[model samples]
Target: MVGEELVGLTPEMIEASQAGMKAIGAAIAVGSTGLASAAAEMAIGSAAVGATAENKDVFGLVLLLTVIPETIVIFGLVVALLLIF
Candidate 1:
């Protein structure tokens, strides 16, 4: 018994640690994208409002541009899904 390794991880400990890491990874994936999407929306939304006020004709195009940032969140969701399952 004296020669036994004093410090080492058991199989269960390794599995638990891996699971926790995966959860953290998934959270980070979703959280960072959500923040990016919000930041992009803030800039685009302000510009779109200003353009609409100056000239009504560009409202439709501006609206489309504002929504483009949302796609970034979807990509993050896909990454989270891949990580989880």
Candidate 2:
């Protein structure tokens, strides 16, 4: 069996590996979300600039809308933390 092949590895080692893998997964989750947030922000920011140029009164609203994509990164961090802990 696979277990027999890994006889030299202690349970602690196996556990450590599992933990490392989970940490990697967590990092990946956060990293991916951060990338997505950046991309979304770029698109939103360009549009916001154009919109703001057209209407000074809407600048604040446009700014708020542009930051909405940041929530995705926040959520990703939360999920990553959950995965790690």
Candidate 3:
């Protein structure tokens, strides 16, 4: 079936797949953390400035978590650029 056909790929295809996965993970981290926390902060901002500020701190932590994953996209971009030049 189609599953068997996709069981293996060439080296280039494998690398591309890895790069795509990495980019996806990075996107989720950056997009989810940044947007979710920002929205949460916005929602809570009016009720309690102090607690909302604490949520901002959590947002910062989430942003930090996003960095490592985001590096994956950077690495992919570097490799792609190198290939182009």
Best-matching candidate per TM-score = 2
**Better structure of 2 and 3 per TM-score:** 2
TM-scores of the candidates are 0.78, 0.87, 0.44
Candidate 1 residue spans exceeding 4 A from truth: 1-8
Instruction: Estimate, for each residue in 1-85, the C-alpha lDDT of model 3 and write its tens digit.
Output: 9778878777799788878877776666555665655565554544455544667656655545435444544555565555434
Give the least accurate 10-residue stretch of model 2, judged by summed lDDT: 2-11
Pairs in clash, predicted candidate 3: none
Q: What is the lDDT of residue 78 in candidate 3?
A: 61
What lDDT does each candidate get? 0.92, 0.95, 0.58
lDDT of 3 at 35: 62
- In model 1, what are the clashing residue pairs, if there are any? none
What TM-score would you give candidate 3 relative to the actual structure? 0.44
Model 3 segments beyond 4 Å from truth? 1-3, 47-85
